[model samples]
Target: MAEQASPEAKYQLGTPENKQFLDEQRESLMAFGHRFPSPGGSSYWLGDDGTPWTDRNRETWITCRMTHVYSLGVLVGHPGAAELVDAGLKGLRGELHDDANGGWYPAVTPTGDYTPDKQAYAHAFVLLAASSATLIGRPGAQELLDDAEEIFLKYFWDAHEGLSVDTWNTEFTELDPYRGLNANMHSVEAFLAVADVTGDEGWRDRAGRIIAHVTKWASENEWRIPEHFTSDWKPALEFNRDKPDDQFKPYGATPGHGIEWARLITQYALSAKIDEAEKQRLVDIAEHLFARAVADGWNADGAPGIVYTTDWEGKPVVHDRMHWTLAEAINTSSTLARVTGKDVYLNWYSTFLQYLDANVIDHKNGSWFHQLDCENKLMTTVWPGKSDLYHATQSMMIPLRDPSLSISVATKEG
Candidate 1:
């Protein structure tokens, strides 16, 4: 067993290391703004020297990504959040309108590459942010909303396969078109956000189509999503399979994606709540995920909560550190509680939240550790403690609303 941390240690002002994560972000964002220029920019940049910036970095690392901040806006309308809305909306618009290709590039790396994968992930953010902006009556968000819808509908949607791509192959030398649960799940999330934000009948109709595609995939595949597929939705055989044989299952069989599928189905359920038949459809998906996750990979006392993969019959294997899975579990379970009016989801969420607060949260740092054993113990790793980007990067969004937990106690990231 590992040494237990005191509540004060766990709950007090977090490690100084955590503060540096955001400081680096704040400072780098500051630097990125002035040194790099883009076709469009927002006002949130500070410099590497922490100076004020006049230029744009298209990515707008700190400001646009302030999911925590945006969550803050959602939960309490924090002062900083209210101040940044216009700027955030503008950045979302610029990102959407970017490139002649009809979708936005991912971001500006240090070398200042546009890196236009035109990913569904960032576009998902576009949906969420635009929705939030519209909620607050921000002026420019409507056009951004239109831009997001157009790109998703025209560029990424694959009618035959019934899924969306993580990104396009246009920029790469060899054409390697791909679709994955991660991207398409994000597309589902984006559509849901837009539908809720606009409250338009058309948005809801579109959201239903996307959700149905996702549900069809999950329904046919044991409530698990494959990691990669061709544009037409055939599995990408022998592509990313060198790890461990058992680990190859859900891809042929994997556990992490079950959590993601659950998360999407959870959102789809919540999005489909207004109509009785739609709500029933979503409920079926949610129950299937819960039942499937329980059957395939969950351990009542395991560290990962779910196994990474199973045989063709659905079994758990290769219990490891998967941040995305864990994050999805937390969010999906929590959302299920909210949507179903069932106390069970809340109870499950509370249990998961307690575990996370005790483990993965890295009160010593700003972000999360990637993995641990299935029993909630930390694992030593080259990628241990802090990661620049991952699904857990946004985990704090929900927890921040829990004041007694001290997520807002200012451990890391300013």
Candidate 2:
């Protein structure tokens, strides 16, 4: 279990101290991610102490996240934020994008070769970053948004099934048989952002369709949404059991995803053009998801942090504590507290913040440690270097914004 909040500790939700903590963290993250831009505008993975790990490939998803983060920085009036956003835009428009092909490349290899497959996961982040950039009136952002939306609709999104497909060959001709919920989850996020930025209610309805499928699956599976799926969208429960910690495609249920889905579903419910009764029903489902993920993931191994994955029976399969999981926990707990007016969720928020300070946040380094063992010791077996600031930055910002609005839009309005 997370240690009890110290008597003088000040992370209680809605308090000035909590706000200040989040503000400080947000600023620190902005500073840490300042070094993300590469020569080609794609993001460089940051090593400990905020140095770019150039040995790694520059990825479209990371670049999009940095673009989205710096766009938020611009809205918040952070110095030099626009330049970083421009750099990310340049990458998205140039190296990270496939001018020969339709959509963005998954990554630019170190040897200057692009990766083979074009993935929905990376494209979703492109849509999100473009939406956020467009909100801030960044140069060429609208063009990027139009391109991303068109490519995604053409290659990834299946209007008939109401769910996005997973991956395709570079030519967009051959689709991979493996479907996934991770990409779709982020699609829901991007859809919400695009809908808000463009004032197109159709995107919101699309997000609703995805959410309906997820909530139904989560409810039937004891609140643990199936991550892996077949081409036909059947749950592939045992897909990666031999490689239980495959980073992106981990086996078993991902409790962090449940926590994240809860937040997104809450945002969708609040933002959807639906009646109060329908919104309340959606919120109820979100609450169930939040409760079950916390019950299954948090302290499942008698530890101080949430575990990475759990079995169908709710047993921990991967005991590592991922930084993003805790971030989502903090975000969802605060969100559920606000939407439901429940102190229990607020207490969980405080607990997660305390856990972040004690276990995840690296005082010596800038950003949070990306991964830690079950014993709360820093480990990078899954995530080697610190990724982009998207998850952690949003974790700080979301608690301070209206649950119904996207973070970039909310930050802009404020």
Candidate 3:
């Protein structure tokens, strides 16, 4: 038999071969532009077989993610990327925008009627997309960014709580009592990107406040950050206990959110330029968060992959694996390796890369598998066809640049 390769022999970050692979992966993701862009917004879903499913309504989050991805493509000199970015911009300004309500809709049907709900999660992505497009020097991007910020601050932001609310009516008439950490996490990400693009310190400071609040919650909860919350910013640990894998609002601690928060908090520390003491505090917290997530998540349920959600006591709650969780694991490991210069993180990085290579990457399809069961077989229990390229594309690109700068700016400078 041929000699079985050791783990180190499989793949390593920063190697020339790995760099070339990342480039090819990026190219493959950029090819998705051909199927995503519609006159209204990007299509909400793409079949696992690589067919565009445009019958579903267009989503604001999908449009924003595609715009952000194509903006990165434009920055990297990919052909035809600017057109896709422009199409996304048009979506933001036209069909997706609620001209009467002064905010973007969560979803818009093919006939142009939009869902009445306005969500902070979708709005945060709008900010992120606009910021990236602004960095790429796209026309009307600055205006979009300005409008997104104004609406977010005026309606969604709660200065007393230091976090964005979960949802609102289209006219901002009423707010949902259900709060969430997911939106706040993405808000931090969007704020950082806006800070980078605008050269403004306020946005970064706002992100810091949000991080401080969430990190406190994470610390108090032993780093298994709670997902659902009351409108008053209290953790509702039992929320959705019956439906543990309800896609967006899952119950219990989400391991993927912890990993993502680790990466984002590290980036915040680097970009904010805090004093040594404060920086070290943030770094220590990030390390704790990442370690806890890895311990509770990776292969905890007699399987060789991370579980989706776990209970407060560190037992697996949802055994199914999610591709985005693995992607976040790769990203957090990469960031920690770079920040701490630790070989252990690099080793973890290599291991996860092996998992991704063997299981997640759908060579037959154009994108990675969205969900896999505990046995590592492809499934769609939580996510349908490859919805969007945001997570996977960012995972591939994040390791190539400095963790301090936003990925778009880092790619542009590089």
Candidate 2 Cα misplacement greater than 4 A, ranges: 1-9
Q: Write the residue-wise lDDT of candidate 2 on 134-236 in tens digits.
A: 9999999999999999999888899998999999999988999999999999999999999999999889999999999998898889888999999898999
| Lowest-sum lDDT 10-residue window in model 2 | 1-10
All models, RMSD in angstroms: 8.4, 1.3, 2.5
- The runs of at least 3 residues in candidate 3 whose Cα sits more than 4 Å from the true structure, single-residue gaps closed, are 1-10
Higher TM-score: candidate 2 or 3?
2
Two-way lDDT contest, 2 vs 3, winner: 2
Clashing residue pairs found in predicted model 3: none
lDDT of 3: 0.87
Cα displacement (angstroms), candidate 3, residue 343, comes to: 0.9
Please, what are the lDDT tens digits per residue for candidate 3 over residues 4-24? 235654357778877777778
Of the candidates shown, which would achieve the greatest TM-score relative to the real structure? 2
Pairwise TM-score winner, candidates 1 and 2:
2
Worst 10 residues of 3 by lDDT: 1-10
**TM-scores for all candidates?**
0.67, 0.98, 0.97
